[model samples]
Target: MIVADLSSRELRRRLSDDGLYLHSGPFICRIQSVLAKVADGLALAYADYPLADADYADFHLRLAAPRLRRWISPQVQFHADVRQPFLPLPQQQAYAMFEWGLNWCVSQHANQYLILHAAVLEKNGRALVLPGHSGAGKSTLCAGLVYGGGWRLLSDELTLIRPADGLIQALPRPVSLKNASIEVIKQLAPGAIFTPTVMDTSKGSVAHAKPPSDSIVRQQECARLAWVAFPRYRAGAALNTQTVSVPQLLMRLAEQAFNYSLHGQDGFSTLLNWAQSAQAFEFEYSDLPQAIAYFEQLASQPHTQLQHEAAPV
Candidate 1:
């Protein structure tokens, strides 16, 4: 049964009791949390995700109040299969912490695939991978594309690429918007659901936008890589898409990968395969509408011979 089948109260009860096993893309995360915000967050953001049976779970996690911290200040600790990996965070930020913690759990432990620090979305079966560091506006642009351009969301944080086939595995999770970007996206997509803002975290004023229900419903769909765009958000900058060489793209992508060296030669081969098959560009833009329009044009263009031609290593 899907999470939507359960009432928020039922979801909370399950979390407090035996835990709630919810499907997230290919993995089932069994969550047990006594913190109310954690339940609220899941109820609001993951209401549409499928709830798995207890017999099948990839990871079991919990968010609970800390012991000593209860006397000093209230805080929450995240536990994966009863093992706590993170220090306690403020009680007010429990939901944000849970979301970040889950992403960390999957990205760090799921080494079966070549994971990259990127935002991925698809349109007409063509997937675009946007890789960037913090403050790069990758999630902002991804939210814009999914809501503003009607692209399907594959993932807003981690991009999982299978080395064997070089196809991107879907992880249609929430889009995180930090600080000013939260308000920016709220205005851009008025209908989108956003968690209440939590201020003064490491990322500063963090909020998560729920992934579109259609994207979550089609989470099993995987697509081949089409374009690798390094997006930079600069104030008042005109829209520019610069062609990046394959070697440079590969080097930059390696720098942003989560487990490039973990897979060794297999990882290198996967990167090579993606670079050879997908177009690469450095995208800089100030105007969100203009940026969306530019991508629309790119998405409409058919794959060309250049996509398959090998570049100098």
Candidate 2:
């Protein structure tokens, strides 16, 4: 059964008591919380995700609302396997904290694959990996591609690469948008569904866009890496795609990778193979619609020998 099979009351009850175990592509996470907003957020953002059976889980997580803190200023703390791993957030930011906390847990501990701080999306059988620094509009660009550009979402934060085969492991989850990107996506994709916006977090007014139901249903499907684009959002800049050398892509990807060194030769070999097989580019844009159009064209065009400089650091 999926999350939509449960009523809001049932979901809340499950989260408050026995916990809600749900499938997130390759991993199963059991989330427990007393915060009502958490239930609301999950129902909106994860309604398409399957409910995992009680027998197994990769992560056991909880959001605790301490009575003392509630009496004082009202806060929520994130716990992993009964140990608090993060500071308490304002009670209103419980759902955002849960989302961010879960990402932290996976990125820090899941070393079976080479994890990159990036977003991955697919069209046909090829994946487009967006690796960018904070405030680089990676998530924003990803949400647009998924909802408006007819691509499937593989992941919004973590790009898991299987070193053995150089395939992207899908982990379709809600796309987290910060500050202005939330409304930017709303305007770009009118049908996009989002959780309630939480204000004044470390990321500044964070919100989450629900992944397309098609993406969630097909989350188990993996794809070969086809393109790696480092996106930058500059005000009023025209859409531009610059060819990047394989060495440049490797260095940049290593900087953003979570487990590059941990995988040793496997990581090096996989990245080298990936660079050989996939095209790399540095993408900068200001207009969302034009950017979407450019990517669509890029995906459809035939691959050619790139004659250009290395990408910017």
Candidate 3:
């Protein structure tokens, strides 16, 4: 069902409380938490027109960050104070932005364990971990992996790594698709549910592609990270495989880290120990077939050559 179509007067009515609206493309998110479906969304008061010099990420970091904590509580209070009934157009518009910001928090919080920025897929008792940075074609590769490689997408953004065991946790978050990538995925997976596209985000005209039903259904069965493969998408670069230096990986990963210092020396030790057990590689490819074949081969190697992603923070 559609949530509130916010107006200045209606927004003022909710002055006593805050509300959340989730808009993704055509669909309005009816968040189903344990307490309620949040049919209209948890009552959180918001402005008719909030700050927007940047994308939803900036809004989340700036406005919502103050209300949020680095860690959440078990019975966390959601801003629930709505005065008027749900609206249509405006609610959807606001939902589109709020949804992204909240999801970003979920991902960042999960990363408290490890700095995982990749698309993850699991199937047949195996989880394929693709670790990379922005503009690395990680999302596009992920779209290909799930659509062609016959795997379940665990995440398209953050792959939360458990600090103690170095186990890669599956964070079932939405996939962020850019202009062409969105079309590419729709062509590949027609049944994929995509939210509304927000104009002029960091990557330009961004949208969120949701997780597969199979992944959602099996969300409880956490997949143990079997292999960590670093993917790189180069326009004209030939397909090549090179060993990534351990120290180099650590440093790079630390830069992307969300909470490396919070865990202190123990966090470093855990990551290092895990690196010693996994094989590290620099996967560069201009062609998709070679990239796919490369990963297929890595799947065959023994999991004895441990590697690191970013160096010690």
Candidate 4:
């Protein structure tokens, strides 16, 4: 059963009692919370994700208001198993806390696959890996491609690469939007669903856009890596693209990878293989529409033509 199958009351009861086992892509997270915001956020943003059996879950998570603090300051705390990794935040940010906490769970513990702090999207069976630092517009560009440009969302925060085949494992979850980009995305995809923006979070006015139903439906499907682009957003700057050499791409990807050193030599070999197989570029843009159009054109080109046209950096 999908999350949408549950009645609001039942969803809340499950969350407040035995916990809700939510299946998204490869992991099943058992979430327990009494917060109304948590239930509402799941109802809207995670409506399409499957409901897993309670027999087992990859991570056991909880969000609850501290007994005395709730009466005074009203704050929410997130727990992963027995550990609380983050300090409490305002009660209004409960849903945002859940999302961020889950991301922490996967990025910190799911080391079976090489995890990169990047967004991955697919089209025509090929994946585009966008690795960027905070404020780099990676998620903004990813949201545009998925909601506005027809690319399938694999993941917005973590790009999981399976070492066995060098293919990307799909982990299509809600894309987080911050501050001004929230309005920008609303303008880009008016019909897209979003959680209510929680103001004054550490990340600055944070919100999450629900992944498309199609992306959720195809969550089991994986994609072969075809391109790697490091995107930067500079207001009013014209679109610029420069080809990244294999060595440069590997070095950059290593920096972005969360568990690169954990895998030791095997990790280096995996990254080297992927860098050589896919074309890499540094992408800079200002306007979302123009950026989307540029990628759309790139997607339509033959592999040979793309290789010939790429200017070495």
Q: Write the per-residue lDDT of candidate 4 for residues 215-272, one digit (tens) a residue.
A: 9999999998989999999999999999998779989999999999998878888898
Question: Residue 2 in candidate 3 has what lDDT?
Answer: 20
Clashing pairs in 2: none
TM-score of candidate 2 against the unseen true structure: 0.95
TM-score of each: 0.97, 0.95, 0.64, 0.96
Per-candidate RMSD, Å: 1.4, 3.0, 11.5, 2.9
- lDDT (tens digit, per residue) of candidate 2 on 1-313: 9999999889999999989999998999999998888889999999999999976889999988988877878999898886777888899999998998899889988899899999999987778999999989898899889988999999989999988888999999899999898999999889999999999998899899999999999999998888999999999998888988888887888888998999987898788777766788999999888889988988887756444454332
- Cα lDDT of model 3 by residue, 213-310, tens digit: 45544544566665556788888999877776656666656655567777788777765665555556777777665566566665556554443355
Which one is best on lDDT? 4
What is each predicted model's overall lDDT from 0 to 1?
Answer: 0.89, 0.89, 0.53, 0.93
Candidate 4 RMSD to the real structure: 2.9
User: Model 4 segments beyond 4 Å from truth?
Assistant: 305-313
